[model samples]
Target: MTCTTAVLLPGTGSDEVFVRAAFAGPLREAGIALTAPAPPPDGTALIEGYLAAFEATAAGVDGKLLVGGVSLGAHLAVEWALRHPERCSGLLLALPAWNGVPDGAPASVAARISADMVERDGLADALRIATDGVAPWLAAELNRAWPRHAAGLAAGLRAAGAHPAPTLDALAQLRVPVGIAACTDDPVHPVAVANAWAAALPRAHVRETTLAALGEDRAALGRAAIEAWQQASASQGSD
Candidate 1:
């Protein structure tokens, strides 16, 4: 089935602008309208709130829609699609951060620690630590975006840290087209997780790229993955 519309969700601490930067143009080129909503104001109940918003948004769409997102967003999208299997035409899940649970996942670990630190020490000290200790670009990005939404960021992190991914059985039931993308060298969104997802999902195709390339062109990651999935579908159809 062709995807007419795709509702893309941003990961923890990410805003609507980041989601648009990640997908809008490429999805539009594929004739899909991208609907990316802003994160809810309440951070404490973020995952539940965001998923509810995603479901509401998907329900409002005229046709069967593609649902997916980055990190926490991607994990919940799988759950979303399965819950309303009839509404999902496809999935554009980027950056599968962890497997079944949040335990031992780097992203989760970071989220929990960050959330605890932010809660206890305040956003200023937390920001200072992150901006000083983390990578140059990330520190810059966080500095620019995190101050205003410190509470929201901490809440999203705490929520994500506790969330779990869809079980293997749930993934196996997803027969629609799936485009999974991840960065090979990035520790947060690992290639192994993408490989596991590609193996579990019946119709998933994966594309491996680098963090540098993604930093340079965010749209390229989605473009490559969707194109690969489309090519695989075409090949299978001809066969």
Candidate 2:
């Protein structure tokens, strides 16, 4: 199947703006149109919003859609693909936080902690703590995104923190080609998780980049994911 459109979702507490910046250029160069929807206002509806957006977008498309996203968004994309494999052409997952139950994964823990901070200290203080030790680019990104969430931010974080990604066993059942991108230096979203996902999926490839590179160029992560997807798709054709 030739997929010309990709519908991507944002990570926990993120919005479509960042998603566009991260993926639009690379996907455009690859001849794929990008659809990045604004997250729902209610944080608790994050997953539902993403799934609904995918369904709505896929409805107007001619063929199967390419689907994926970053962090929690990637998890939701996989979940949607598993449920509707016939409508999905492939995956372009970036920075998958964990497989199966979060089990105190760094990303999960961080989300939970941030949620608590937002509730206890309010958004301003929470944002300060959240961005305190992050890279400048990351901090800037968060500073811009976190404010948008505002009152709903804690709910969104808590929802994401509690949600479970597809397990490795479940992943093995997904036959669609998958391209996973991982940041070598991202402790929150460890590279090992991406490697494990690639190992489990029948038609999958993993590409590595660094957070430093990502900071220097927003498109770095998207380029890695697109390249990995191309490799996976080619391998599928050969098979």
Best by lDDT: 2
User: Hey, what RMSD does candidate 2 come out at?
Assistant: 1.2
The residue pairs that clash in candidate 1, if any, are none
Q: lDDT for model 1, on a 0 to 1 scale?
A: 0.79
Worst 10-residue lDDT window, candidate 1: 230-239
Evaluate model 2: give its lDDT. 0.91
Per-residue lDDT of 54-81 in model 2, one digit per residue for the tens?
9999899988999999999899999999
Give residue 23's error in model 1 in angstroms.
0.4
Q: For candidate 1, write residues 33-148 as lDDT tens digits.
A: 88887777778788778789777887677768878888888898898988898888778888888878777888888888888878888988988986785666566667765665
Candidate 1 segments exceeding 4 Å error: 133-135, 236-239
